[model samples]
Target: MSDATSLLTVLVTSPRLPAGLMSRDAWTALEAAERVLASDLEDPLPAAIEVSGITVTALPYDSPAEAARALVDATRSGSVLWVGSPDADPGLTDALAEELTRLDEPPQIEVLVGSWDLPGARLLDAVAVMDALRSPGGCPWDAEQTHESLAKYLLEEAHETVEAIETGDTEHVAEELGDVLLQVLFHARIAADEDPGFDIDDVAGALVEKLIRRHPHVFGDGDASTPDEVERSWEQIKATEKADRDEDDLLAGIPVSLSPLLIAEKVLTRAARRDIQLTYDDKADLGTRLLALVAEARAAGTSADAALRAVLRQIARPATD
Candidate 1:
């Protein structure tokens, strides 16, 4: 599993201020939480919090965070973190000045059971986590990828993001979007490696500028009502901004590599713009034509799509046919 899912960030906000105090129950919860957390106990603590049922580890060791690390581990194991007045003596607070060195996982993380959830995301910072993937000292496969080679993956990730939204899975959509973002970051990293000027920030800034420049309706004085009008305005602005390019015809925009069905659809769509109509309002006519096509395809040993393509091809290039 990816670290994102496994990593948690639990924040136990106390109703009271952070006066180095916690309720007994909260301390107990923290101890329970520690069992599940993975700890990197490298440091000492500024204080030694002592509770009847729960124990805040001793202080004044090598690192300052030793006590917190123990608590983190304990909290992960289901220890409850206390936010209110702590039962432990105030002396522990100053003594528990343990260094909060980062941990990928905690053997135990003490969190208040009913208190704010201690999310796992903050255990490791972004740079520290992604360092292994994007570093010169990281994975060779990841380091070798380039913008062009990763384009298809970016597209696929975007498609998955769209699917996730359409299906109304916000969390899944978030995850998929993250995948897309990773691809983007990966590409940007490659671009930076290839040309020192193009980093992730540059890419983001360029897009932001493009959006503002194109959206005179939203960001400027141009008037556009509905989404369709906004889209029309956007297209016009984009066209105005874009430089002239070589084109044999308006139809040249459609790539030849599209499947025949899609190509036929596109060609016919363009024809419709020129005032051609292909309509079948009658339900009986629709059913009869569909059945006829299926039967004809069976007889010809071809799919309905293929047969439809053949017909569209004749109509599309009538003079050549």
Candidate 2:
């Protein structure tokens, strides 16, 4: 190697991604290097590099200090590239730094990120953890959970997430959101173990398909300039999707499991969308009054369920002297 090209390159790649998937710079550095070394030749990245017709020499050093000395010695003669271990080659970088300081003319050392994790990569970790917990000889409590048994926890997590958002603590909200996600992953894992055709991927795929189908303005050429127009478009798309169900009933598809306030809001919204005027008598019962309050809250663009929850929280607070 020439004077300018004589260097030590520490190449790191994301273990989560395929070994051969690397940046152009990484491949260029590998091609330019006089020697490419790895502690283990059988490791995925080294093996992949070998398949690409690049010679990857295995360093036989038993310790990081010894490996560091060998790397520095190689770099002094010519350009040398060290493939980082999946476990981050613990203590190797520190050992290299110490070794370099003792030398009068150490080769220029630089860390190169060959590959990085993409967005939502940590979701893979969540899936793996859920699988492990539910697997045999794993967590006994997690192993015993079923969808039906875990349903209440899902509802609780959602409510907690709502409360966390209301408090305006972003960190708390994120934590609560994680709890909600855990329920989803847990249920998906259960389904995967028992139901052959269903998994988290199926759930996510259906959601993605539904989002694309519904948002015609965004995904297709359909025109919807305003939020109201977009919402109307969604309702129309949903109606068409549910054409096999009873089309005559305006509230046919609204989930019955929702809180009474939310149920009332959905019913009122559905009725308004259909241009069906619904009225209550002057001598309306308590249920009718509650429904009317929900409608009032909806008209004011607020949640009656949240309003009631806030008042209850206030009442439950310990009195200050």
What C-alpha lDDT values do all the predictions have? Answer: 0.50, 0.89
Would you list the clashing residue pairs of candidate 2? none
lDDT of 1: 0.50
Worst 10 residues of 2 by lDDT: 1-10
**Clash number for every model?**
85, 0
Question: Could you give candidate 1's per-residue lDDT for residues 1-321 as a string of tens digits?
Answer: 112222222323432233234455644445553322211122111132332333433323243245444444444434333332222323333333332234444333222333332363332233244546878788988877777778789878876786677557899997998788677667766766663557766887899999898788789998888876776676566556654732224354576755544455544444434445444333567555664445445446555655565576569868653
| Model 1 alpha-carbon drift over 4 Å, by segment | 1-132, 246-321
Candidate 2: Cα lDDT at 26: 97
RMSD (CA, Å), each prediction: 15.1, 2.9
Query: Could you give candidate 2's per-residue lDDT for residues 143-212 as a string of tens digits?
Result: 9998899999999999889999876889999999999999999998899878464789988999999999
Error of 1 at 92 (Å): 12
lDDT of 1 at 223: 87
Best by lDDT: 2
Worst 10-residue lDDT window, candidate 1: 37-46
